[model samples]
Target chain A: MNALNLLRIAVKALQRNKLRAFLTMLGIIIGVAAVITMMSIGEGSRRSIESNLTSMGSNMITISPSSNSPGVRMSGSSIQSLTVNDVIALRNQATNLTAVSPMVSASGQVIKGALNWSTSIQGASPEYLDIRKLEVSEGISFDESDVRSSAKVCLLGKTVIDNLFPNGENPVGQIIRFNKIPFQVIGVLASKGQSGFGQDQDDIIIAPYTTVQNRVLASTYFQSIFTSAISEAASEAASEEITRILRETHRLRATEENDFSVRTQAELINTLNTTMGMLTALLTSVASISLVIGGIGIMNIMYVSVTERTREIGLRMSIGARPVDILMQFLIEAILISITGGVIGVIIGVSASVLVSGILNWPTVISEPSIVISFLVCALTGVFFGYYPAQKASRLDPIEALRYE
Target chain B: MSKILEIHDLKREFKVGSEIVRALKGVSFDVGTGEFITIMGTSGSGKSTLLNVLGCLDKPSSGTYLLDGVDLKSLNRNQLAQFRNTKIGFVFQAYNLLPRTSALENVELPLLYNPSINTKERRERAIQALEAVKLADRFDHTPNQLSGGQQQRVAIARALVNEPVMILADEATGNLDTRTSYEIMSLMQELNQVQKKTIVFVTHEPDIASFSSRTIMLRDGKVQKDTPNENLQSAREALNSLPVTEDY
Candidate 1:
């Protein structure tokens, strides 16, 4: 028989038990929806992280002194191996280096006209703002002359400004006390919102490294060295050059391990992306189990249908339907159910992803290739599970089937 | 008249758990075109097995059976299906009409297996067959909506829809009352007489067998008697004489 006619017959048969058919399709629907939702969530998070990383400066790299002892645990920036001399050496030797700054961070209470807030204070050169992609919204950043003179001028991040100066007052040229030391606010840094780890990115104050080293924390050694590449594409080359320079300047023997660790933003992004990708794959695999279960449900229903319609099959055979015709009829019925389910699943999956994004405030990306792949999988599920039952129907002896009560 | 079917020494055996059961034992028969014949037997008399072989639903264990000019053994499974589609029609005891399907679509079923016929022709032929069976007005009715006699008529229309060489009916009137049985028999008689249709009917009822031109009585997997009826009864006259019951 022609495919159209066969399909019609199959539809008619399914129409006899609409509830059963719908229930059978529900399994596939849930399976496809789960897969799509998980994949979209993963894609969305990856994209979100990538954008955050780029905004934070994709080519930025951090060099921190490693822990000195083998058994003792120490904070990353506690070691005093990296210093301003290494930053100068990296700036001079690294080919693709655009900006190099020595960083020293300390948390302290800052007070402006009786408004007090505790915030992190970062001390670095004027180029630190450029390396960290921090733009000044008002006033000016501390210049190199300010760094050399140990000027007590600082830039306030938006969060810190809001907390320390709450009266909608621009803090430029205002004096704020950090650890009982008065410092003039040079500028208000632009808002960077939250980082990928949910930490507030705009809750800090930046000052010249010389002032922070001599006046605030009274530190002699630099905590970390931050550098930026000329372009994101050149960050890897810049990292290699910085490693060679730091190794030679630190005078580490060729056979000995280096006392510093250099990490590029690209590495962090790659690691996060890999983690997100793995999560998506794990979720998708779990969802595919449902599709398999759905296929089994179809097979179970098909087996029952074959048994219930044995006499009908016999009657058709007696009339003129070949074994292959019977097989095709049942197989096509299965495919029709699954394909319909798959289409509905795609719709539900997209909607569910949208709903999740809206309600939970999570990012979601609906990919077209995933939809196409799920459809193909649904078709395969139909054929794979429907085969045995259809084959059983086809192999039935007409005489015995006709005799079936 | 040319013989429509010929069977010589046909044997059919079944293995029931290592025990051989011979369903048909060396039965031989020839049926001419336009002939109305009845094969009568009790349950387990092998009439059903013979009918299956005749309908090409089963192959005889050992025999030289021919339908028209083609050897039944020479045809493959697919060819046999085609042969059944084009050359034979079957009527079952339960009517075998698909539930929830319209009478017209049920009749169009046989034509579906015939790829040579298009959709429009299939519909037209089905309507014509239903019209021939006097069910044109009930074309859209399902089997549940029709009476037993009407359902049987629809089944007969389905059998005739493909314009087969012969109609094979197994207990066609077995589910009907006397009047309904008589009504179906009358319809068959009309088709045989006016349309020159070949018919082979199987039944256990001797009264039903009286309407045919010839009767073959089978017992214990063999034909006990094969004789031509000298005086064939008219089912129309029989229906007229019977008392009418309330329409179902």
Candidate 2:
């Protein structure tokens, strides 16, 4: 028989039951829409994280003290001993080392006459602002002279100033008492907005490393250590050199691990990105499960159609229609359902993704490759899932079918 | 094998709810070219089953049946379909025309399965077939639009479109009025005599069976009697000699 004639009959039969055909297509539409929407959200999140990490010192490295126990406190193993002596020694010994600052921090209530504010006070050298990309709004940072003399000066972050001042009042040159010690607020750090990880960034005070070390504590030891590498290329090597110097100065032998742990800023970002990427892939794949179920639904409905039309099959057979003709008719019906649903699903899914992203103020990308893959998957599912029913329809006994009421 | 249809020891048994009902017990018959034979039997006497076997719509359980020089038992499903497309035509008691389809398209159905005939030839042949049945005036009407006899005539035209050597009709006039029954019977007789088309029609009525040239009586799946109708022409003449049954 002519292929065109067979197609004509199939089209007419499918058209006879428009409501049933539409309902079947609805299942496929939902499945495909779920796949597209979930994947777009996952992709959007991945891209946002990539850019967020790039903004927070994309090539920066960070080193923190070691905490061997899972929930242990992590100041440092030798928190009471790291001093400016150790900082200067490392700066001189390592070739790729750029700057070093011995840090000491204390949380206390800051007072300025009628106003009082509580915040963490951090101390570092003049190069701390450059390393953290902090901009000083007023007054100069403490230099070598200030570190040597142990001058009591401070730099205030935007949040600390707002909490203590409220009005557009100048904080520079004002005397702010820290734990009852009179220290002058020499400058203020410009606002650095919220980090992508939801951490408040501008709620602290900066002071000279000397003042924080001597005034905040009555001890001769430092609380922490901060360092910066000359360039991104040498950051790893510089970290290793600093580790070697710390281990030797702490009187540790080669076999024994030191108390300090060094962590790179790049490594933190990498771990975060890898975990998010895995989450995206897992979520999208789980969504694909619905598509498989949709395929099964298509097969089941086709089987019902073939069985219901047995007498019609017999009628065609008597008119010289071959078994393959029946098979092709059923197969084409299934394919038409799946492909049509797939097309509508893609449109609906893409629009849904756009709507979600638009309302939430996030990014959504609908890649052409993903669309193509989705359509192909839908077509393949039709053929793969519809094969058994079509074969069963083609193998029906014409005489028995004609006898069927 | 040279005959248009031949059967030897033809038997068909069917099981219904644990009972093995033999529709056709050991029946054997042969039909040569241009022969019009009528099979007469009661409801469960297997006349329709015999026609199914003759039309190649069924397979005899344990018998040798030949149709148009090919063994019916040896042909696969696809081969049998092709053979039916070219060798056999059928008209059922129900006037089994698809009620939704137009007369011309119904006639063209068989020709579509025959690949040797192209579109122009197929349409021409289908029109000629409808013209032969005198349904050319109602070519566009669906089966429900025509009378029972016209529908049967359209079915006959469909059967003739492929120019098969024979047609097997199962109680072709059983559902029609007496006048329409005679009209359909006379059409078959004219095709048998003038066009030399062979036909085998099944019926339970003796008057309907008397219209054919030969009569084969069946009972309990077996041929009880087979003989030439030496008085067929005289019988139809006598039936026609009565007042013409009309619905004015």
Candidate 3:
């Protein structure tokens, strides 16, 4: 018989018991839906993290001093190995670096006409703003002359302005006292809503590194050094240059371990991507178990159908239907059930992903590959589970089947 | 008359749990075209076995059987199925029509296995066969909606749809009442006489056997008698003489 006639026969047979066929398909629907939803959620999170990191300068690099003693538990914050001289060495020698700056910080209470606020005072060269992708929205920025003179002029972030100048006063030229030392506000830094790690990027102040290190902290050592590469692809080369120059400036011997670490924004993005990819793989595997169970359901129903239709098979055989024809008929029936289930599953999964994103406020990306893979898996599942039953029906003895009640 | 079928020393054995049951022991028979023959036997008389062999449903263990000039023994499983489709028509005692299927579809069953017959031709042939059995008006009725006699007629229509060389019936009237049985027998008689269709009917009733021109009696896996009937009764006359019921 032709394939079309076989398909028609299979459909007619399934139509006899519509409820049973639908119930059999439910298993596959849920399985495929779960797989798609999980994959979308995972991919959405990875992309969101990448974009958030990229917003903060994808070519940015950070160099922090490692603990002096490897066996001792000391925070990198207390380490004083990085200095202004190392930043100068990198600025002079590193060809891959687009910009470089020394970082120093001191937390203290700032008072502006009795409107006092607690915030950290971060000190760096004017080039620090370019390296960190921060823009000055109003007024002028302190230049290299200000750093050489150890001037006390500062820039106010949006959070500090909101707290210290609550009356909407133009604080660009206003004077503020940090730790009882008066300083003039030179500019207002543009708003950077928040970092990916939940840190408020706008809750700080920026000044010349000389001012914070010599006047506020009374320390000559720097906390960290920040730099940017010419491009994201060049960050690795830039980091290597920093390491070599810092090692030479520290006068470290070739045999000794360097007391500093260099890290790039790309490394952070890769770590997060790996973690989320693992999570997606784990969830997708669990959901595929349901697909397997759905296949079993198809096999079980096919077995029952074969048993129920033994007499019909016998009648068809007597009328000259070959064994292969009977096999194709049943096989086609099982495939139809699974393929239909797969299509419905893809629809439900996409909708479910959208619903989850809307209700739970989670990021979800419905990728095309996940849908296509689910469909192929459903078709394969049908063939794998449906084969034996169809074979069993095809091998049935016509005489015995005719006698079957 | 040209010979439609020939069987020589046909024997079939069944292995029932290490015991060999000889169902047909060297049975031999030949049937000519347009002949109406009946095979009669009691229970366990091996008449059913002979019928199965004749229908190509079971191959004899040691025999030579030919139908429509093709060697039955030389054909494989698929070939036998094709042979049955093209050369033989079968009617069963229970009127084995598919439930929930219309009479027309049931009649089209045999033609479906033949790839050369397209959908339109299949439908036309089915309708023509239904008309031949006087059931063209009720072609859309399912088996449940049809009377037992009407269902048998539909089964006969299905048998005739393929235009086979002969019709093989196993107790075709075994489930019918006397009046219904006579009506079916009359139809069969008309198909045999008017259309020149050959028929082989298997039954245990001598009264039914009287309607055919020849009777072959089987007893204990062997043919006990094969005789020509001198007084072949007309089933249409028999059906007409029966007293009409009150409902009619």
The candidate scoring highest on TM-score is 1
Candidate 3 C-alpha lDDT tens digits along A102-175: 89999999998878999999999999999888999999999999998889899999999999989898999999
Order of candidates by lDDT, top first? Answer: 3, 1, 2
* Model 3 pairs in collision: none
How do the residues B23-93 of candidate 2 rate in per-residue lDDT, one tens digit apiece? 99999999989899999988788987887788777788989998877898998888888877888887877
**Alpha carbon lDDT of each predicted model:** 0.91, 0.80, 0.91
Candidate number of the best DockQ: 1
TM-score value, chain A, candidate 3: 0.94
DockQ winner between candidates 1 and 3: 1
Docking class of 3: medium
Estimated TM-score for each candidate: 0.96, 0.74, 0.94
In model 2, which regions exceed 4 Å deviation?
A: A1-10, A68-193, A202-251, A264-296, A321-328, A362-388, B1-3, B13-22, B25-37, B94-165, B173-198, B205-215, B224-248
**TM-score of B-chain for each predicted structure, in order:** 0.97, 0.93, 0.98
lDDT tens digits by residue: candidate 2, A284-319: 787788888889898888889888888767766776
Model 2 chain B worst lDDT window (10 residues):
B233-242
Report RMSD for candidate 3: 2.4
lDDT of 1 by residue, A323-370 (tens): 899999999989988999999999999999999999999999999988
Pick the winner on TM-score between candidates 1 and 2.
Answer: 1
